[model samples]
Target: MIKIPGEKLIWMYKTMLKIRHFEDKIHRLFLEGNMPGTIHLYQGQEAVAAGVCANLERSDVITSTHRPHGHALAKGVAIKSLMAELFARSTGCCGGKGGSMHVGDPDVGMIPAIAIVGGGIPVATGIALAFKFQKSKRVAVSFFGDGACNEGSFHESLNMGAIWNLPVIYVCENNLYGASTSIRVAVKIRDLAERASSYGIPGVVVDGNEAISVYQATSKAVERARGGQGPTLIECKTYRRGGHSRSDACNYRDKEEEKMWLTRDPVVILRERLTKDGILTPEDSKQMEKEIEEELTQAIHFAENSPWPKPEEALEQVWA
Candidate 1:
């Protein structure tokens, strides 16, 4: 087991709880018809975001996918702003425009998430190129799904990042299925990390269910990027607890496979580990949960009370 500071462990644990609870709240809201648009919940993959973002500095930016709430929260986006965005309120991070798939706050170092498949890969690479040009040590991380690995943009971006030694990391969260398609059906390679060899960059695979494992891998990749070595591709093998979208029943997934992954729930694993290691007391854990619930409740209230955007405000940010 990798040694992590107790404080950091607690932080990761809290973050995972926040992501889980936030998604649960959103799920309920969506079902209750209180939220507009749709959501891609990050219920089971909380460890990946918490672990990876813990290694990043406030200056290091991350590009997110359509499933962005976990990334946004881990990257320090305010819960209230994100909730407001889902509520389509004027006070949202995107002023009620970006909604669920586009949640982000650049002041906190996350670009508004790109909903298009594999779209953010090249964007993150470009940001890394800019970082290199300016001689900054900051890194850019692109979080994409397994489906995105096959996209032409993924290949081109990796090639460019490798050639220029860009300060970037390509994190592929392989949750087995992309939408309704299994990764086995889409890609021939058993290990997606193998794709990195073609570009001459280091490739790594980690247990996405283990926060310490992910943090350690990201730390190494970030160190390499800062040293001007090049980009690193880290594939996190995780599973999503929920369906792909709001309407999905997940009937396509096998019950046995779901049972297996459920046993390894990241949040529960970490909490137990911390308790057993004497790093977290039951009292402390309970307090943390209470605090998170209160925080989320306050965020919901803020979003519910926030005013909607004026009709003309929609035209303000349009460029084309």
Candidate 2:
């Protein structure tokens, strides 16, 4: 039983809807050959981003993994700017330099998402250190796949964050696969959160497909971090409704497994929960859906007409 403010509940549902529609549209754009480069979509795992971010402030920073569109949007990045980034338009958050996997906006409390596996772990830990040194109460969160847990950076980052009592939350989106490889075959332990005990920090497992559960877990961790209780490793057990990337067909996963997770779809779950409680009626659902559609339509239009960066400007953002 998770209790959230009525307005916050609706906001969470809307955020999940936005992520769903945004990723769906991105998949379409890629198929139509209108989008540049390959994409690692955050289709089914909307709950992780929306749930966690609902408890955060605009000033609280977060770091994202390759699948970052959801996190960017959840953290308050403008939809138009995000769509433009996917389109490689000059109006993008990274000025057309960061597309798809690199989607982020510092203005919205997200740095350009780290495309490398386990790369952002140490970066986020460092950001937490900086926050501590500056005496700022702000917290930093790092979102990574379960595969990142095996990386040395993950171990080092967790250890360092624990020892320093850094204000960071390590969110492991255990979608059960590190790309095409299954988590079952990779790690001996089914629950990755258990590894946090080695570092003496709180490790939690949450229903990542359920927005309320994820929100509650994150809210507690955020509160603890804000009170200087150190970092928490939250492992969210969820599934990626789509392939690992544009080139992946996800043929390796069992049909039954995908079907099971699909039934627990985050967006649908939230809507039903709200509707069941009479917080959201049939008409309210329709209105929310319509508004989201309109917003996404505007985002697409903005991306379509946006300008591209000049060829000469490529070297401008690069450092020698």
Q: Which residue pairs show backbone clashes in model 2?
A: none
Off by over 4 Å in 2: none
The superposed Cα distance between candidate 1 and the true structure at residue 140, in angstroms, equals 0.4
What would the per-residue lDDT of candidate 1 be over residues 1-320, giving only the tens digit for each residue?
45678888899999999999899999999999999999999988999999999889989999999999999999999999999999999999999999999989999999999999999999999999999999999999999999999999999999999999999999999999999998888999998999999999999999999988999999999999999999999999999998999999999899999999999999998889889999998899889889999999999999999999999999998899
- The TM-score values for the models, in the order shown, are 0.98, 0.98
Best by lDDT: 1
Give stretches of model 1 more than 4 Å off: none
lDDT of 2 by residue, 1-320 (tens): 45699999888888998898888888999999999988998988999999999989998899998899999999999999999989999998888888888888887799899989999999999999999999899999999999999999999999999999999999999999998899999999979999999999999999999999999999999988888989999999999998999888889999999999999888899889999998999898888889988998999999999999999879887877
Error of 2 at 296 (Å): 1.4
Relative to the true structure, candidate 2 has a C-alpha RMSD (angstroms) of: 1.1
